[model samples]
Target: MRRGFLWDGFDAGIAAALAGDPDTARDHFERVLGEDPLAPGMVDAQEKTRELHALAADREAVAARVVHSCRSKPGLDPVRLAMS
Candidate 1:
């Protein structure tokens, strides 16, 4: 399912961010956003992604931070992590 793929991608991005791969995480987050900009938690994801992007133009930094934050957090559910 497209939704499933997006969710998985989101999860991966979060995981990647927590792992310190901001670039990869950013890419995944971007992909998820692109897939469903109107999704429930897409707005938040978009905001976070944008922040990460602004934090570092380099993709690596973005991914790293994203993964790190997601991993450290307790309520980062990809399915519920929409833009709404």
Candidate 2:
């Protein structure tokens, strides 16, 4: 399930970011992007994670934004929300 994989990667990325590991977060976000670049918040998550990795600033806020984007994308599947 591509959607499931994206969710997993996104979740892992958020966890990594919250743990103050931007490199790992970027890696997970990039993996999600690889799976589905156009999937909802994939691009934003990847870009934000990349910035977090490079700038190393405000990681918690970045992670929170990533989680919000992933959860709040318009027209997202209700089933996917349940899955997460």
RMSD of each: 9.3, 8.3
> Which 10 residues in a row give candidate 2 its minimum summed lDDT?
75-84
What shift in Å separates residue 29 of candidate 1 from its native position after superposition?
0.7
Model 2 C-alpha lDDT per residue in residues 1-84, reported as the tens digit of each score: 256467677677767777778778777766765664666566666666465555334465665555565566775543322221
- Tens digits of lDDT, candidate 1, 9-76: 76776666656677877787677667656666776766775665455445455555655677767865
Worst 10 residues of 1 by lDDT: 75-84
Q: Which lDDT values do the candidates have, in the order given? A: 0.62, 0.61
State, as a TM-score between 0 and 1, how close model 1 is to the true structure.
Answer: 0.44
State TM-scores per candidate: 0.44, 0.50
- Distance from true position, residue 59, model 2, in Å? 1.7
* Model 1 stretches astray by more than 4 angstroms: 1-4, 37-84
